[model samples]
Target: MPAHVPDLTALTLLVAVARTTSLAEAARELDLSVQAASARIRSVERRLGAPVLQRGRQGRRSSRLTARGALLVEWAGPVLDAARDLDAAVTALRPPQPDADPVVLAVAPTVAEHLLPGWLVHLRAGPGGEVALLGGDATLDDPAGDPAGAVRDGAAAVGVVETGTALAGLHATTVATDDLVLVVSPGHPWAGGPGVDAAELAATPQITRRPGGGARGALADALAEAVPGVAPAAPVCELATDAAVRAAVRADAGPAVLPRLAVAADLATGALTEVAVHGLQTRREFRAVWPEGTSLRGTARDLLRIATGGRLR
Candidate 1:
């Protein structure tokens, strides 16, 4: 016998083979393919240092259990029975159904306005109570409205943020990605022109989000990396939200870097034009973050699953 006993799966497969007297039938009963079942038995035999089944010279048709295999099957019966009992006990101890607690979601403005609404629609179509939504500019200058901060402070059960900053003390997973584009009104001088380079963009005064917002920070970082030793010029106008900044840009306030999702409609409708910025990359990730040391249960986990298209658990 192996020092460590074979796992439950191997033992169960052996028992199935003995009961059915056909390896192929045993695999079908266990929902395993024939090849997988064969490999599993081979693994068990290697661990036991003996053959479990004797195959006829013809093929799998005349296979039979070896004497050692018969003995293992007998010993494995009690173990499998005990495992079933343990499973029943554990199932009884668990809650009968999923928890139905109210879920609160704190979301960044861009994600809330652009991506989260559709996610919420799908979430609401299923089993859940009213989900309190807190959406705003989660900037360093404004912690009160910071989505990640809300999760860290226990004010919200989950948060969605789009930023390059590492969220300390929270478990974060990427759900989607977005790019920021420089946009100007169709009537602006730079509109429909051959895009500007990073240095030119860095030196130009334009409408921007108020200092410390995620989009502003992303643009600044990209510009700094593209043009070393250079900082972005002061904004001609600084606004607190992407919507306000977009409105300003639409009114010919000046060129502003904004999320593509936020401007896709306006660009499609000819209300705004996207200006290409050469040598400047502004792609950012959208993340679902929750407090560390706490597993997401109930509706919170459901919402995350929806946001990630059922990928995360």
Candidate 2:
């Protein structure tokens, strides 16, 4: 033993894996790669001088915790619970500001990482004036859960999501557009070609986001309509983050459907080439949503105005 406390983050990961019973699922929830998760677990085990988990078969399923691992989870649970309580207590002790509402926005990982920073800068520079921006991740299968649901349930003042259809009980304003493009490394066969047809695209294995994601849904809907009998090829790799998908495509893993915003730099630098797919509609609208019938006021209204470029839909 090193005579020091275990890392809080490592302990949290252990609990996540123990509950999910799958290393990949835990990694996805924690926004980590499987390799990274494995490393963290290994480090924790090394510190304890005991194996905490039994590895599972590759490409099949998640690993299970050892009896000692279960014991670690039991010890960690109360520490985590106390930490949460401390956080809440600290938040409750903060003085309330009369001028600012501290607007919290929930958004998907792609927008949060790539698009929201610019928007935040613009909003702060505009008439909103010293607005406090609190951001939350609402990526698919996120440990914190869905962004749209967060807004709908009033946990957040607004949510920016990628969708073509309106969510029930919410007022959706189309704030921006993201075009999903089929991309490949510059050396891949699809590069500089006339592009693939619907059937050909359907039959090609590609890197992709996990199912149930906004991008995945848009792709599925477009493919189902355009090529009735054909289904998309099995994913060569499925990841929770667009960055991972882009990285895979850049490494020549396979052709991937990725947001233009995500691959813009790569396309500009000629590191990746965009391929057109005939008869496929790849554009998905990014909408700012809030509970319907609730009138926007104060900072919330100002944020909505800023997000939609002075237009509210």
Candidate 3:
């Protein structure tokens, strides 16, 4: 609250600990030792005259945040978000170098489809920066559960995930998000009109996203809840790529569940349509996943700003 206050560093460290819910995670994120992070928190709390967080159990989980701490988090989050945006804007105007490390972006194929094309074009033409982008097999259940050495082995600088489970060892920042839709071929009656219930959609032919992949089974899982043990039936074809799935639908493939962003172009062109599922559309989250050992770089930050498509929640 003081104008001349130093050590926003400690404040951020405390914030990181609260966000990550573990001292080890906070230390890894802050590039500090667990012991050192613990000491810093202790020192700050002593000075503040109140504990900021309660260590749950033997300290593996943080059980609570004091009222004062809650107020700080609420106040600080938006400020930090804005500050990061300002930093990104400045980075965008700078001329890039030939020798700069290529920004590695791991993304979901659907996001890579619409946003990536335009975003990359903007980056190269505008930033004139060298960069490399990567995508995982969406057919694969979860990238986090992939080869332990994969992030290290691939030397991946960042990973993008589409789920609720928090990926350990990465600084996760959210980007674009969309509702999951039940996709149908142009010829399908439901494709032309209003949304249908989950039960009806389940009974009809369904082209599920690859089983176990990101949010592929979300609708089916929801369906199973209402009618125990009833999984949404699969369509004749099981395509992996977003573009391919749209093409399949155009060719009269079964209705598929896809992120609205993934099928925006198709729907606009009348190539594919969504039949409403009774329940609410699945809320899908798209996040930028970065390795903890590496902090955010100026260029990467700019890329993120542009990639957000001017959308952030």
Candidate 4:
């Protein structure tokens, strides 16, 4: 380790002086004041203990490289070329940065509550990059607060929702599956016996989620397919959240259909009973969605990957 190695600026200034044949001209080309460029040369000479320039007869304005300066210029050529190469390599190797603004994630209630926490934890611990996420309810962008609509409208960069239906104007992929089960308090009559028929279930007034919710929409679609021309019976109660619906059902409000993920513990502990529904398909898909034309990258892509359990799509 030498005490005073000439820096890149000094070396570059020397090369420029060699090419321009005048210290003032080289300084001008490099956007440095003549005094500053002269100081750089002096600094280099002090470090190297050698003269690197020859002053011409023209009032010390014109310059020429000394024997040592000519050798230095030749040596500095490769070093300078390598420096340029190193700079370009560094620029090429650098990763493209994600948008500075936090990526907005709109999520449906069930997925947001039951699944998002773990996914976000994984995202934080994983290798992708910084996860600057702003999480919100699926309704963030749309007046209706529909996750699909929020994504399509560009209100959110990504969305996680539970649904079995196709979303127009958006690209979606299944991340998980949930069964919408008909559940009641342990004391309800449906808790003990034979499965209810699809038609009978459709006609029974039950506690349910609000119309726009995923479970409610999925249940409606399934019932419509199972019993065509007969609309579902109006709800005895319409709740805004899964917890509310579950609490109401636990208190014997009415039998309500809900995602099993929301009530699995209650079902296992016999706090609630899952009544069978004959001829009805309650299986629904939980999906990650984004606007059709856009490609997910950076943290957005990383979140999608984690949600899909490490599968990159």
Candidate 3 collision pairs: 195-276, 196-276, 197-278, 198-278
- State each model's CA lDDT, in order: 0.79, 0.75, 0.62, 0.77
Candidate with top lDDT is: 1
Task: State the lDDT of candidate 4 residue by residue for 1-313, as single tens digits.
Answer: 3676688888999999999888989999889999999899988878878778876667363468889888888888866765664443333224436654556777776676566656665665575344322333235233235677667777778877677678888889999888888999999998898979899999999998777764787788889999999988889987777888899999998999888888997898898999999999988788889988888998889878888877856
Over 159-251, each residue of candidate 3 has an lDDT whose tens digit, in order, gives: 555655577776666776778777777778775676777677667666555654434655656667655656555566665566677777777
Q: Where does the lowest 10-residue lDDT sum fall in candidate 1?
A: 88-97
RMSD of 3: 18.8
Clashing pairs in 2: none
Per-residue C-alpha lDDT of model 2 across residues 1-313, encoded as one tens digit per residue: 3464477778888999988878888889999999998888888888889788875566332478888889999988867765554443334234447865566767765566556655655555565433332332234564434768888777778888877676999888887888888999999988899999888888998888877543676787889988997867898978877888888888888999877888887899898999989988787788888888887777677777877889886
- As a whole number from 0 to 100, the lDDT of residue 21 in candidate 2 is 78
Question: Of models 2 and 4, which has the larger lDDT?
Answer: 4
Which regions of candidate 1 are displaced past 4 Å?
1-101, 134-146, 163-169
Question: If scored against the real structure, what TM-score would every candidate get?
Answer: 0.60, 0.61, 0.55, 0.60
Candidate scoring better on TM-score of 3 and 4: 4
Error of 3 at 16 (Å): 51
